[model samples]
Target: MKLEHRIGQLLLIGLPGPQLDLMTRSMLQTIQPGGILLNTHNIEDAQQLVELTATIRSLIEVPPIIAVDQEGGRVDRLKEIYSPMPSADLFRASGDAAVAARMGEIASEALRTLGFNVNFAPVLDIASDDGANNGLKGRYLGSNLAEVVRLAGAYLEGLQHGGVVGVGKHFPGLGDCALHRVVQQDQCSLECGDRRARALPGLRRSLAAPLVAVQEHSHGIIA
Candidate 1:
């Protein structure tokens, strides 16, 4: 693929199903997006998922990467009948890397079974002092950077072992920010040298993993 086409492939797009047929046709005919992301609103059931993916693939000259936010825990989108997963913090609370690995394996397997190739998950944010860092209340793996990195790495490894790609998110750290980071008004702990170093470990792990891509959260560079 040319650089232009390769760059095109990096784009992930969301489209409504009712209009998917037309929109996909247009994207293929025009934009030729590299991938399509399915949201809860676009999914109905197993058959629907298969049908939607098939239709979208048919439109594109190359098969587009299929993705979804199937993180177990609070951010799950595929919750029609699947078993609910505990949040990352809950996994860390278990204090067992094995348990976290198992959960990641299960999450990857479920998404693989559902025909999703990429899963946006393993939120590797640090959430210490829950009262002060309310934003990391649930999505966090742990407050300690070293432990968080270890646990998150285990989870990503498990997911990869299950043939599913894992993506790390909300870069530069958002654990200390108040809830809804973009709207929040608090100085992030990342400003602290040690805290900033903590956040990078998980990202480094993801960079080493054979992931599809890291979902860049909409936060401008702090400095």
Candidate 2:
């Protein structure tokens, strides 16, 4: 690949509508980005979603990665057409690894049917019970590191089995910080480092397990 094309592969961009407009088509043809991440604005229903993704894919020579934040609960993108999924906390409460795994399987099936290849899910953040102010309260697996690893591992397994790739998120951790607001970069780094230090052992163990497959995406870097 040319250097320009190689650089384009690093971008995973989003469009503003359910269908590709002239500008989106032009951009895709020019850059040929490696992936596209869709949100609620780009999805109307399952059929529309399938068509939109198909159109986007047809524009590029290489198969592009189609991704969505289908983590269920408050972050789900398919809630309008699909059944609402329970929060991550609910699975942790059940204390059954299979529950998380089943949720992943169901989510993957829905996403794959809609032409999506990736699901940003199985939040590994260990949210506090009173984490509403921190923005990660109900989205987390649990505050217990062991439980988070167990549930997240199973969830990853289910996603892979269902033909969708799962991307574990908000690393090194976001349980204590509210990402909606701004903070000094230095302070942010310190907090993230602390959280990682506390969670590192469990993270290592989880990654070493056969079922875990995670990729990090930083959503709050100011640069």
> Per-candidate TM vs. native?
0.81, 0.87
What is the clash tally of candidate 2? Answer: 0
Q: Model 1, stretches more than 4 Å misplaced?
A: 1-7, 132-135, 180-198, 201-212, 219-223
- Top-TM-score structure, candidate number: 2
lDDT of 2 by residue, 153-199 (tens): 88888887898888776666666554444463212346565765577
Looking at candidate 2, the ten consecutive residues that score lowest on lDDT are 179-188
Looking at model 2, residue 204 earns an lDDT score of 57
Query: At residue 50, what lDDT does model 1 achieve?
Result: 72
